[model samples]
Structure formats: structure tokens, C-alpha cells
Target: VGRDKLLRTLQYFSRFYAWYLFRTNRPQTAIAPFESIKKQFGLTRKILRIGKFIEHFKAAAVAFDNKAPVDPILRCLAVGRQLGYAGYMSYDTITVIHALGIKKLANPKKMQENAYRAWLASLVCSAIAGVYSLWKLHQREKLVDRTEGEGAVELKKIQKYVFSMQERAAARVQLISDLFDLPIPLSGVGIVPLDDGIVGLSGTVSSLLGIWSAWKKTA
Candidate 1:
């Protein structure tokens, strides 16, 4: 529980720092997109009447003017997300280590009880983090969609910022996915999956070692 709390604290700090930078370093005066397709083409009516596609691209070309890019925010987000994942990995590794130590206890039940509590606490914290990640991703997606819908003029002004957030979000999501789905390459012919399966296997091996230690004590 202590270790997980420490990791969680680190993750929160990373996010706080990112948000601080994002707010303080925000770019100046930006224009929103101009939605004209509904007014000129009346997309639904045109499609219903002619059963054909409307030339919205031409309309967009005529309306858009801004071409400048917005300040980038990906680096801030990338740093935070990577730190957060590092915390998670550390937490998981410690949890497995604790599980492996279970067999070394003379009174295994007491240690098991504490381990279960720690596991439960970590699980709850992990669930909260996962929810927050999902929520943040959803918010970023909305930002991307809003910017894109506004057309190129508005998009051009803030496209880079939105894309940066998107790229970071994609990378974070990929990292989380890869944690469970990908394999770790340590050296030649030393590839192994870095998922819960490995954690379980490692914990079991540790427990067996602990048993051996206890048997030696008895002997």
C-alpha cells in the first residue's frame, strides 16, 4: 500500500505539472471554425432530392483562411504519461515481489492478509487511474473533433495542439496495451511476454523459493 501510494503520488504530480504548463503556456487569440455546409447545401435535403454527394470540400476551401499552427503540447503530455506508466510498472513489480515473499513467512496467514489488503488497495487505485485515463482520452478526442469540424481556418490555428494531445494519448494508450499484449526483449533468444501471466509465474517461482527457504529452516 505504501509503495502504490508513492507511485500514485508521482503520477498525480506529473499530471499537475503538465496541466500547469498547459495553462501557463497557452497560445494567444484563436479563431473558431465556420460551419456553412448546413446553410448552403442543406446536406440532408440535397442528398434526399438528388441522391448525390455534395461538394462540401469546395465550400470549405472558400471559407478557410487561417494557416498558422498552434503551440505544441505533446511534449508535456508525453512526459506525464510516461511517468504515470513508470509508476504503474513499479507498483506492479512491487506487488509481485510481495506476493513472492509470502512463502518466506513463518506465519504465512498474517503476511497473506496484509498482501491481500495491499493488492486490494492497489487494484482500487489502478481502477481509478484507468477511469481517469479513459476520461482524459475522451476529452482529447472531443477537442480533436471540435477543431476538425470547425474547418481548416480554425483548425490551422490549433491543429498542432490538438494533434499533439492526440498523439500523446495514442502513445499512452499503446503503452498500456503493449504492457499486456507485447513481449519484452532482454537479449538474444530472451523474449517474454510482460503481462499478468509473467507476474503470476514469477510470483509462483518466488513462492517456491520461499518454501525451499522455510524447509531449510525446518531441517
Candidate 2:
């Protein structure tokens, strides 16, 4: 994940830089360097993502088991999110093969469009899940009752409060990342009118968030 995030950050930055050059009427010679970097990193990321659908597929299966005592709606959202990601990865894997000339797809554009749609669905599910989780946390916060506890009870309450805060913070970060990512897929699928510059910058922001999250986990 860390490697992919780093590559993604560079890829999107290249994309944005290339667009910036073009928008400012810079010579094609000026834009070509970043354009090449963007294409190369994009292909490399696609290669790295190959076969990743299996992971998300397993996650979907686990979510379907419903072993956790999570809220019903959140559970459903989790399953949908995993399934959507699995679908996106599956389609994207094929596109990668076509991209590398290992296989010639008859309709590469259509395949990419489908992949983007699946990704958009996944992000939407994630965003909704984040909002619902935040709402649930808020309800729990109201019931925490920090005033009526003593000694061990007070410590327990304090621990729970801290955990809830952590969960809330994580949810907010994920929601922001999803929001930034939404524009990329939306533009890819022609659902929204966004130029390459906007899409590229949005992708860069989302990639940086992914990097930060991965770094925190490692640290």
C-alpha cells in the first residue's frame, strides 16, 4: 500500500503538472516530460494492482459473515464497499493486460469506463459509511456520561472516550479522501464535467491522504 500510494502521488502530480503546462500554453516540449512520467507511473501502478481483487473479494466474504456486532446499515455498506472495490480491481486488471500489450482488448475504453464506475460506487459506499459511523459515534458520545464515574469506572469511560475520538478522526480522514477521489471517477465516467487539471489535483490529494494513513500505520 505504501509503495502504491507513493507511485500514485507521483502519477497524479505528473498529470497535474502536464495539464498546467498545457493550460498555460507552454510548448509541447515542456509538457512532454511530465506526460511521460504520468503514463509510466499510471502503468506501473496498474501492474502493482494486478490480482488485488482477491483481497477485496475475501474482505467482502468476511463482511458477509456478519460476525462483528456492528450496525446493520454499516455492515451492509462495508459489504458493498468491498464488492465494489473487487469489481473495480477485476476490470482494472484486464485493462492492465491490454495496456501492457499482453492482450488486445476489443473495447479497452469501455472496460476502463466500467472500472471507473465500480470505483465510483466503492467511494460512494465508503463516504456514506463514514458519515454513518460518525453519527453513531456522536450518539455514543452523548451516552458516555463522564460525570458519574469513579476510579476504574472513570478510567474505563476515559478510555472509551479516547477510542471514540480516534475512530471519529479516522472516519473524517477517510471521508475527506473519498471526497477528493470522487471527482476523478466522476470525470472518468463523464458523470461530471471536470478537466484533467481538476481531476489530477483531486487524485493527488487523495493519494497523499493514502500515503499519510499508511505512514501512520507503519509508524
Candidate 3:
């Protein structure tokens, strides 16, 4: 009778343990479905945010307006070119005076003064050009990035305009090349053959003349 009682008790304990395990596992099994739903919800939100961002960029691009007449990059390049020419002229003037042994022709201090002017001018021009070039380069990069995000149509328009400008610039460069090729005397003195110094001086004169003419036109 005791053995039978013990067997019955062991069977009862086993059944109770199985029921407890099942009860404990039910919540964990249900959590998997909730986790899947959460993952799907987060993915959908991210996609929506990205779509909104792209639409905002497109709207802004459609309303883009740059009404200013003057292009800063072109003006900066022009100024840098003029300054480079002027710097070259200053340096060359010293070289010419020294080479011709004209120190004795003028006051001894004149040579020193000219040398100082040349180095100072060259240094200033170089520093300004370096800084402006770097700044303008970065600005162009930003402009390109902004344009690219606009859309295909805007990018095409930009490309077309850039090509047209390039053609115009090429023609201007060719004209300059032809003009420089012509034989021209450097100075009224008739002794200094047309050299790089003279070319630099001519560039300075031409740039100044263009600026003066533009000013007059505006006035």
C-alpha cells in the first residue's frame, strides 16, 4: 500500500512540474511576435523620414534663386590675375635695373628701394592669390554639392551653362594668345627687347584699361 502511495505521489509531482514549465514559457513565446512588430515599425519610420528629407530638398531646388549680377569667383580670378601680373612687373623691374648695371645712373638708394618694393609686392600678391584660390575652390565645391542634390534637370542646366562659359573662355584665351604673339617693343627706350617683364607690364596695363573702361560704362 505504501509503495503504491509513493508511485502515485511521484506521478502527481511530474505532472505539476510539466504544467509549471508550460505556464512560464507562454509569455516568452508571445514576446517574439511583439519583437517582430517593433522591428517592422522602426524600419517604416526610417523610410518615411528619408522620403520627407528628399522631398524637402526637391521643393527648395524648385524655388532656388540667385539674382546677383556679378559672379564672385570670376571677379576674384580677375583680381588675382592682375595682382600676379603686377607682382611680376615689380620683380622684373628690379632684375632689369640690376642686369643693366643702372645703379650708378641713379641714387645708390634707388636700387635698394626698388628691390624692397619688388619683394614686398611679390609676397603680398602670392599670399592673397593663395588664400583667395583656396576659398573660391571650396565655394565651388559646395555649390556643386548643392546643385547635385537638386535633381537631374537642375544638374543638366548647370552643365549646359558651364559648357557655354568654357567655350567663351576658350575663345578669349585664344584671342589673348594671338595678341601676345605679335611682335611689340617693350619700352620707349628701345633698348629692352620684348621680354617677360614687358609682357607682365602689358598684362597690367590691359587689365587696368579693361577695369577703367568697365567703370566708365557703369558710370
Candidate 4:
């Protein structure tokens, strides 16, 4: 995961830098290198992501069996988020096969379009889940009583409160990352008029966030 995030960071930064060089009227010789780097990293990431759909599919299956007394709406959103990501990854796997020339596709462009559409749906589900998680966290926080006198019960409440705050912080970061990522797919599906510069920079920001989160998990 860390390696993938690193590649993604480099890929998007290369794209943004190439756009910058062109926009600044740099010589083609100067801009070509970064463009090449961008393409290489993008292809490498696609290869690395092969067969990743199974992971998301497994997660969706696990979510489907969740019997916890959480809100039904949140549970449904969780399942939807996983399924959306599974669809994205499955479509992406096909694109990678086409990219590698393992099999010629009749309409490579349409395959790419479908992959982007799946990715857009996944991001939408993720963004919505993040928002809903934060709202639920806020409601949970309100129910914690901070004014209780010192006792075992008070200590437990304090601990729970701290944990809830940490969860809220994580949720906020994810929400911001999802928002940054939304423009890429929006532009991919022609829902937005963003140029490469805008999309690349947005992707760079979200990639950095992914790196940070992955680093934390590893540490």
C-alpha cells in the first residue's frame, strides 16, 4: 500500500509538473520527460492494482454479515461503499489487461470510460460514508457526560470521549481526501470542465493524504 501511494504521488506530481511546464511556455524537450514519467507511473500503478477487487469484494461480504446494533443507514452505506470500490477495481483490472496488450479490446476507450464511471461511484459512496460517519460521531460525542464526578465510570467516559474525538479527526481527514479526489472522476466522466492542471493537482493532494494515512498504519 505504501509503495502504491508513493507511485501515485509521483504519478500525479509528474502530470501537474508537465502541465506547468507547458503552461509556462517551456520547450517541448523540457516538458516531455515529466509527461513520460507520468505515463510510466500510471501504468505501473495499474499493474500493481491487478486483482485488488477481491479485497474490496471480501470487505463487502463481511459488511453484509454485520449484525451490530449500528444505524441501518450507516451499515447500508458501508456495504455500498465496499461494493462500489469492488466495481471500480474490477473495471480497472480489465483496463490494465488492455493496457498491457495481453488482449486487444474492441473499444478500449469505452472500457476506460466505464472504469472512470465506477471510480466516480466509489468516490461518491466514500464521501457520503465519511460525512455520515462524522455526523454519527458528533451525535455519539454529545451523549458523553463530561461533568460526572471522579470515579471509575467518569474515567471510562473520558476514555470513550477521547477515542471518539480521534475517530472524528480521522473521519474529517478522509472526507477532505475524498473531496479532493472527486474532481478527477468528475472531469473523467465529463461532468466537470477541469483541465489537466486542476485534476493533476487535486490528485496530488489526495495522494499525499493517502501516503500520510498509510504511513500511520505502518508505523
lDDT of each: 0.37, 0.93, 0.42, 0.87
Error of 2 at 45 (Å): 0.8
Q: Highest lDDT: which candidate?
A: 2
* Model 3 lDDT per residue over 7-110, tens place: 32333333333344444675656544544443443233223333233443343343233345645554444344344334434434444544446543445345
Q: What C-alpha lDDT, on a 0 to 100 scale, does residue 120 get in candidate 4?
A: 83
* Model 2: per-residue Cα lDDT over 1-219, one tens digit each: 888889899999999999999989999999999999999999998899999999999999999897768788998899999999999999999999999999999999999999999999999999999999999999888789745478888888989899999899999999999999999989999999998899899999999999988777778
Q: Which rank order by TM-score, best down to worst?
A: 2, 4, 3, 1
> Cα miss at 148, model 4 (Å)?
4.5
- Indicate which candidate wins on TM-score: 2
Overall local distance difference test of candidate 4? 0.87
Q: Residue 217 deviation, candidate 2, in Å? A: 1.6
TM-score of each: 0.27, 0.96, 0.28, 0.94
- Runs in model 1 deviating more than 4 A are 1-106, 147-219
* Residue 113 local lDDT, model 3: 44
Candidate 1 residue pairs in backbone clash: none
